[model samples]
Target: MIDEQIFLSEQTQDIYPSRYSNSPHMIPRADPVVYGSDFSNAPIHRELIEQYQQQGFLVLDNVFSDDEVLMFQQELNRLSQDDALKQCDEVITEKNSGDVRSVFRIHELSPVFSQLASDFRTMELARFLLGDQVYIHQSRLNYKPGYRGREFYWHSDFETWHVEDGMPRMRALSMSITLTENFYHNGPLMLIPGSHHTFVSCVGETPAEHYRQSLKRQEYGVPDDRSLEQLIDEGGIVSAIGKPGSLIIFDCNVMHGSNGNITPFPRSNVFMVYNAMSNKVAEPFCSQKPRPEYICSRKNIRTL
Candidate 1:
């Protein structure tokens, strides 16, 4: 059941309405970009905070050392070789090649990922930005294998989370750690500088069991060309390219996506989402059955 508080409260109902599934709509963002004000416990400084506020995304290089990257990389290789993981429903494979595309609930799949999720640098930044205790809304390892890798179409994550997972607001953020160097030619993540300020009500109804297909190539909840053009025209596009161990922090509602990685260099990264504890998920606003536990955790919610 949808939380009564979320349905009736002022915070969830009309402030950031989306899906339009019936009729599309667009509105300026209602939520603040920088949710937390106090920086005493913040791992980053004021300039970075302001940058996050103004641009809606920030990239930091050398967040993890080479040794750490190597360890995680090896772990990923191990997970890839484990035939059991390959057959699990949590694993999504590429469209054509059948190579692994993504593995969800990574923290639960391996202790190495568990440690990375709770690492001071990533978690502290999430807490500092959210101004409250936080928890992992979702965790995954995204892979764009060398040639024939697929593209993740442009879309706001909150759009899907709100409609499918029952998240009420945009008090969430994403931490993407680069395990392999993200080169400009190898389908790096791209984002509009200030597009997070716009709420794009995507045109599409939530199909039953959509996550099965959406994880590989998202079709629904995707913004239209007209809407995307307006955003790109205003904020412009920037490719987040960096060496291994780079970290990307972006607003939950930011407009971003990546292209197909046909280059010989494959792109892989660790993705963790942190949501403010105050904004716990309830019943999905779209009325679909809640996504599986691996995708969005509602029961036994734990503060990180």
Candidate 2:
């Protein structure tokens, strides 16, 4: 096993320097259950802080205006059709129809995306969860096209980042803002409410392969049929069904996945990862070097 303490120290010091002196375990998992009814109305309230800290996830409605979301929708559609943009690896295409599957690194690609990253509402909530100076770790727009969108395998993001990107611990969170209505029938994201508390180490050398295999076989890192039986029996899965402009904040270690969109309705959303500057990534464990800054950002500039 790796000397987790020293490894953690090295990770934190990679950029911020001396911010972390102890083991990664020094950061404990949040409580499992918290808050009461009527919490969503005032999510910024301190009481609800525990709600997210405990369940490892929180869903908020109407974070963006409908007009803003429509503008973004139009922008993404336009970009999807641009041949110049299509040539970029950031724009992934579907295997069968050749339609766009996802667009990565949009924080630098669009002004609206950059503005969203620095938005006060997003920044305030991110700071509450990730500390005062959080940086954008990754950003992507997932377009689950009607009837052809693929399934994302069940897995904790932190697992991949930890081993592949050299992140020492789960001091990060993801905020997914919906650009289209996410009905249950449209392959909305599914989460095991408290799964973030447990780390699942399914065998996989790279997340890309794990995802490719998962979409093809439904057997990638997602809990196996047997394991699913136990995890669901314990925590139960929750479908993230919401309208356009709905925003969800989730822990990086949360066990989550979504089904393939076989229905006619398309589901698209933008998700950005906010990583604490104190949790900077160290040297890679599985690769000879770290991924490019576009994928795994190294900039320590505070977005908020």
Candidate 3:
């Protein structure tokens, strides 16, 4: 077994440089849930739930307005340039190096981020997919610049994030919304269909090891390969390409990752991971455990 501390240090090195980059640092805004009580009645919202379950993923085109996407992108860019967020610059994955120069929990940064982190549409969708009692577990903005080679390896989000027996196959869902145009050239998101139903255990590996293996694979390297296309042809995978404002919702257990950007411009997106309140599973035992941070700011929310 990997030593817990060593394992954690590796994972930490794989993600950001230190704990400060991952912990919650933003203040919360007024609760958006208080704005209305009839969220379950939204038609498109209902459709989102059905589509997610049937296909194991759903793409909502133009879910955010172009203006909204631009605004968020501006904030992300501004924050990326700040000294506080840039402290962990050396440790970020190569794929995320450009836009995500520094990593900070969304809720710890600003009220707008906080509101979006706990948006009603998102929370409602989470409840619909996982049940009414759901919690926002992790959230981050993934910044990808054009021409960067740091693409993630094909893997399930749940594989490394949950306890063994107590794992909930469909306990959580993740939402990735593009803040900029995402196309084949810009490393759009990719997913393997029905892989969520397969039980594959992801033993905790150092982030560095994960990065090295991904870099070695030609499928993830430049000049784009046919492997992803073949998967799509075989009905095994799907490419999620969309303009800014589109959202892709998928089961946490689904096998997914992105290719590196080969375009001239950068692509940016924000992600939030929500786990059904009913499912309380611990992360798999790692000799070196990277402590999980709260995505939502509890201090800002007025408990009902």
Candidate 4:
């Protein structure tokens, strides 16, 4: 279970109630507009844009090489066995009995991760999706052990919690990179397309509760207690199953979340969130703050 106290920190400023717009239902839809007109001249194929516009997400196969994945995975496993990582008791949480889940802020822990966080291929794709000047706001590794466990509640990363008119575009895109193969049987990610544009008030609630309510409001017909598998069969939901080197990049507004690992092996992955660096925003919502330099130094790095 997520610690409720963490929500009260000032660093989590981007997450708060809005004074400008009423609840999601009351806010009028902005005029329907096609994106990617002026900002990025780089030839992002029409299909890629269409995919994001229609589904709120897109998958890139084999973004990392097999050797790279193996190296990163080895490094992560090594870190897991280290006393330093184990001593980060504050960031670690327990679920479903004694199964401990470690949430490591990768940029601070691993050089490889920090280098990859600002990698060119990633930044260029981000620039295409968002605009120029992307700042990596957060990076974390979730290590979920194999076994029976409480599911990770479904929720959006950008939902407001405390401040009014939260920072605009503070988090524009989030990239989830699977360190290991995330097959359907191992609790892969499941998301509802086009749910990003629909705002939901999820303050003070667990992810599971927020997800259930969102589905009901959307009339998606997903039962509150249904497993992710059950929801997928009903239609529209997509499971992001891929090889270890693949990645799924989606807008922060997207409604995305995952379940617990039921397979005998552990399910592990690293998540990195990037935001377009602009002056229109205030402080972020989470206590995991990034340095000002890190935010300002982003350059366009493209890989062919």
Candidate 5:
């Protein structure tokens, strides 16, 4: 069966001009997700690169061993339970249940996570895909406690990043390494395959300090049902499910989100955002101020 393409316009902009300040139009993605043409020295094979390019995401199970998963799990427990980190501004609690929802700038918080960020498996793959020396634009630990964790509405990361953080182009990607088994019922991350080809400019005006609420539950910057449906009709949604050591790497503009976990199994993952050093952040396109450093790192670009 052939895959269907919708709204594949001939127009290609130099940059992905996004949905901002009630913008109604959807910009077909012009930027290439995988910039590295020569993968001779890269870890992944040619077929894998094609698969990732065709679909918006790549799922690799057992990317880490049980021992490494255990180490990550222990580190997860420590950081989530740390009195200092729990009280820090970097920590984000669930809106309703008051449970810990996310912890940002975690690579700066713990050496274990920092080490994982620099791990060749994760780092080199990013370098290969981004086609340049990369740095962490952002890193965080996401935990969705069972029964109380809330759903993250469907949206594109680059939409938020570009409008808020001044990310100049769709030249970044996120790699999420699972620290816990992502069961189907545990609110695993979901992506619309092949949906990265378009940029759905959102409808609402971004409020100041939106990150304060967006981390727990994003309200604005979400795609309208019509735009989301159009993309989903062309490329169906798939959950990134796997064992504790699995890795899911996806484009920065891919449409993704997760449901709230009601089952007893809690889901958690370590997320790292890699940006090409040449594509550093600038002034915001829509917002009056850039997001806090923890959410969008403007400095401390590391090569790994």
Candidate 6:
């Protein structure tokens, strides 16, 4: 059940000031938007803010250093091999080969992951997209292994959250930081630009199935073939192919998906979902069982 205190309380606006922007929503995009220790200047931050609002997504290059990426990769690999991780509900594996597909709420379990979630640059950008006091609602590591990675169907994250988790609005966004090269052939994320303007509600006969497992759904709560075809024809899909340390921030309501990885190269990314503290979820509205807090967070503590 959703916490009543969180749902009814008024939101606070105690945001920390940063060199990036005077206001949370005014991030500029510099003439040459390159991410680094000193790339969050006024112009680039403002541009980034505008681009995210207009297009429902923004991709920035070189957000993290190569060494940082290597460190994260090594840690994630260790976690994948850890036998204890198999017992946790947070880990989701491929049905056939048992390869790890995703590990959720990593921040809650690991100190380094928690620090990464609270990273100043990431939190500041998340505040710009969400609000001043944003909460780390969900964090996960997604892995698309070579040759056998699965496909994610076209569905909005907010749709699942709103219906199943009882989130009231679309005041959340996700940051995907690439740990490996997101190549064109390695199941890079595909998005329909400007698709957040419409909410594609879906209904099917099977309600007994779990919602978090998008791949295992017998009947998915996603757009039908005709609707999907029309949406793709009009909006056009974009593949976010980039080197390691690339970052993509996307609106939760955007229609997005990815194909199965057929190439030998593997794709991996760290995904963090930040939610406006004021936009807390209510009681479960559409599902018999609410997913565990590890998958859908109930805490609303401000990250910054």
- Cα error, residue 244 of model 3, in Å, equals 0.5
Clashes of 2: 1
Cα lDDT of candidate 4 equals: 0.56
Evaluate all candidate structures by whole-model CA lDDT and list the values in order.
Answer: 0.87, 0.71, 0.55, 0.56, 0.86, 0.72
User: Which 10 consecutive positions of candidate 2 have the poorest summed lDDT?
Assistant: 16-25
Query: What TM-score should be assigned to candidate 6?
Result: 0.82
Query: To one decimal, what is the Cα RMSD in angstroms of model 2 from the true structure?
Result: 6.7
Give the Cα error of residue 181 in candidate 6, in Å.
0.6
Displacement of residue 143 (Cα, Å) in model 4 is 1.4
lDDT string, candidate 4, 9-106, tens digits: 53453333332232222121232213345534644567777777767788888989989888888877777667655656324545335333554457
For model 3, residues 1-304, the per-residue Cα lDDT tens digits are 5699886765434221111222211111111211123546643565555555556688889778888888888877777767665654221434334345224466446566668766766676666566456655666776776765456667556544542212333477788878888777777788877545443433223342232233234221111234334434545667898888887888876667777767776777877777665444444333333333432222233210
RMSD of 5: 5.9
Best by TM-score: 1
**Which ten residues in a row are the worst by lDDT in model 4?**
214-223
The runs of at least 3 residues in candidate 4 whose Cα sits more than 4 Å from the true structure, single-residue gaps closed, are 1-35, 38-40, 96-100, 160-166, 203-235, 279-304
In order, how many clashes per candidate? 0, 1, 12, 14, 1, 11
Model 1 whole-model lDDT (C-alpha atoms) = 0.87
User: What's the lDDT for candidate 6?
Assistant: 0.72
- Model number with the top lDDT: 1
TM-score of each: 0.95, 0.81, 0.69, 0.70, 0.93, 0.82
> Per-residue lDDT for 16 in model 2?
17
Residue lDDT tens for model 6, 90-174: 8888888988888888877777788888887688776655644788878998877888777778877876776667666678889
Clashing pairs in 1: none
